[model samples]
Target: MKDLDTLKYFLGIEVARSASGLFLCQRKYTLDIISEAGLLGAKPVNVPIEQNHKLGLASSPIFSNPLAYQRLVGRLIYLAVTRPDLAYSVHVLSQFMQEPHDEHLEAALRVVRYLKGTPGQGILLRADSDLTLQGWCDSDWAACPTTRRSLMGWLVFLGHSPISWKTKKQTTISRSSAEAEYRSMVAVTCELKWLKGLLLSLGVRHHKTIKLFCDSQSALHIAKNPVFHERTKHIEVDCHFVRDAIKDGLIFPSYIPTKSQLADIFTKALGQRQFEFLLRKLGISDPHAPT
Candidate 1:
């Protein structure tokens, strides 16, 4: 067995440590993707995707090369490992990989261009984090124009640093925004439970109830209230664990205003100002950005 020196790089991710925190990035990998996408000389955009974009309805000509679009989006999936801010953008782009069109390709390139300006942006695990577990969950009702399905996004934090995040579509159509938001709460609750188990296995016992925040007051009421109303009768029985978790003291439900919802970045394409504002709340930064 060979003895390796201090950790530096692994699996295309670059790692660095300092007095402040441990930083992880894919600067080389990001640059390679941008250059291959032919956006190395392109101007950077403030946001990854356009606001209120009808990407699902884009009717532009089919891309001349579908393979290129698939390959580019595939690379982005890898890059997103350390770039939580890219989660929503990559999710939206990957959907069109099967039959990518001109507009789809252009949107994928916009993501690359956004990365061009800050290739070194990545996760920072602070040295002095408190290690408290918490999470934010959100949903965009009927976000899919094709299927009329909802989209959900969540971000779980181990202390101030994000450890896990995801943006996904609901399998079933949600009849109301509250239903969509409640479904998202259920999804994030499951994630927080698994994370707690992982921490326990690491000898970090978290006795306190994990906090899970949502912007929907209706969903919070549904989870906290034991008696189900006829309005919520349609929710799947198996998904009711969210209420059970609250009863077990495993989760503490809280309310947050929509404008301040950190999970908004994962659910919808936002204007530049709102997107940048939410990114800051997620503890994401570009330490490598020019001063």
Candidate 2:
């Protein structure tokens, strides 16, 4: 293949490069979503979902058209590729796709409205960012109104640029908040190892111990302490894995205060002020906005 110009757009993502760094956004994709949803000229919202909103299976009337909700959620999932700020909202709405409810549809629409506020908002990878791996892991305990499963959220940053993140529902019900946090750490540990391997394959030198920040002291203690007891027996397997990782010098787990936990934005909805704060910290900004 002949050499082509630099990548300006690919698979709905619009990429802009400069001396500062690369700015990637999906403005057209998001606008199309809003247009298809008939939300043109709709009033924009600051946050995607209401703070502490607990969506349940039996919350409202069944949506007449399941296919419509499914289609919208499907598109939102793709949009999340460049809009990590919308990750938690999209993940929450996707859960209701099998059996759509009017409430769920409304929530999804709110996300679109939120998008209307700043469709150009996307990730920024600074040119001067370092190569050191940094991660933040957090969990929302017993947040689901239906399954009661905890939500685990983590972000892996390569230097100042966030390279990976996920918001997932735990596979098993956790007995305590600490248990949920510990399980979240376990998930992050696995992700970190995979990322390290990927970096090594690429010939990138990142031998410095990866720093993993978690807000749960109990979870860190459980991972560091070798002793297992009746309280942590249910999650002993995960404990051992985390302990081994720490012992092997793969990751260094440290405590970060809740307010400073960037991963908090992924596990639960926050008020507009706090949500925007975390959004900025995540390096998501509206490229079209005034400096």
Candidate 3:
């Protein structure tokens, strides 16, 4: 086997190391996407998607080229490997793959334009970051205009470096916001457990209790108290494992105010201020920016 030495690039991810930590981005890949979308010279937006977007099953004209939309979204799905900021937008647009509409393609192109602004932006894994596993989960209740299903999202951090995150639409309908948030808590809890085990196998031992935060006090209450069973009977029995994790001391669930909810970016589109603010919070930076 040929020894390639230190990793510089792998599967489109460009890696760079410095005194602070390891940085990864897809500058070339991003540029290619922008060019393919014919937006290399388009003005960039402050955000990937507009807040309160109307991207649902509507009577709008079907896109002339459905394959183009599908291809763009597929590339974007890979792009999100290092660009979590684009995840929600990609997820939303991906739903119309079978039948992309004009508005959907516009939204996809908007993402390509956004990339033109900072194609080299990526997440950082700081060398000085502590080995702490913290997580935040949020759900946008009934956010889908078509299905009325809630979108659940979460962020898991290894100290200051974000390790894992996802935005997924809940399969079942949630009767209340509390139920939606609680379900998101369950999703993040599973991810945390899986990550903890993976880290342990990699020879990193986490001594501190894993902390999971959420903005819904009602969901927090449901996880911390058994009395809520009567109110949560409709919730799947499997989701109840979140409470078990708490009881077993595997995770500590806490309440965070809405404004401090970093996972909100994953659950729904947000204003420019909140979007950029969360990007900073997520440890994303453009290392290629001019000094």
Candidate 4:
């Protein structure tokens, strides 16, 4: 019927092409957010959230206006689609939208200030011959101060390009770091299965088993070894599901060093050095950065 032109911009996301591949960013939308919040000229920060600073309800003064807080956080959440660096911070701040405190509002503003520094920062989906499905999953165990629940983060890469990702809180309280990591592995496994099926439907042939990486060796052993049955009793169902995937040759779980963990950026706040390093590793860069 109608053949639309190639996508340039859709729903606030700007798309650009280069000899390398595609770059997606929300520069205009990010700038509008800063201007709306009256922080256009505000000082920029290196990272969105301060390390070791845990925010919770009743931690600071009640915000004068709750509506503004909700609106700001909602917009930031939408912006995270193209800016994975903002996912952890936006996910943290969105929790207090109902009755945000002054500290929460300040934290949200700090994220906007960070965005001011590199509004053009976005994901780079490079063109590659490799079509292998891979993923990195990580968890911050009991990072929440109030509930003591853990946070899960994952990134699914088709060859070198990150296509799907998530930063979310786990539904259940994990007893130990290993358990938390194992649960994250389960989540990523499910994502891999769906992604593989989608590729098949699109007529993309991938015969190799998807490889999943995690920094936790204990989690890897838990998925492969039946000896940890006692310790994994609580999560027995999850264990079987993951083990079955490995057995059926659908996924292959492996270990990665902590420093090389790509999903760490999604689970917690980081210092400037490590944060920028991981950002580069994740293929997030601003072509407009000072030369």
Tens-place lDDT digits, model 4, residues 48-130: 99898768645777898999999999999999999889889988998888888988988999999999999998888887637
What overall lDDT goes with each candidate model?
Answer: 0.90, 0.90, 0.90, 0.91
Looking at model 4, residue 226 earns an lDDT score of 66
Error of 2 at 91 (Å): 1.2
In model 3, where is the ten-residue run with the lowest total lDDT?
227-236
CA error at residue 64 for candidate 1, angstroms: 1.5
Q: For model 1, which pairs clash?
A: none
Model 4: residues >4 Å from true position, as ranges?
1-4
Q: Write candidate 1's Cα lDDT for 153-243 as tens digits.
A: 9999888888899999999999999999999998898899999998889999989899888999988888877787778888847347887
* Stronger candidate by lDDT (2 vs 4): 4
Model 3 accuracy (lDDT, Cα): 0.90
Candidate 2: pairs in clash:
none
- Misplaced by over 4 Å in model 3 are 236-239
Please identify model 2 stretches exceeding 4 Å from their true place. Answer: none
lDDT of 3 by residue, 95-152 (tens): 9999988999889999998999989999899999888899999999998988899999
For model 1 the TM-score comes to 0.97
- TM-score of every model versus the real structure: 0.97, 0.97, 0.97, 0.97
Top-lDDT candidate index: 4
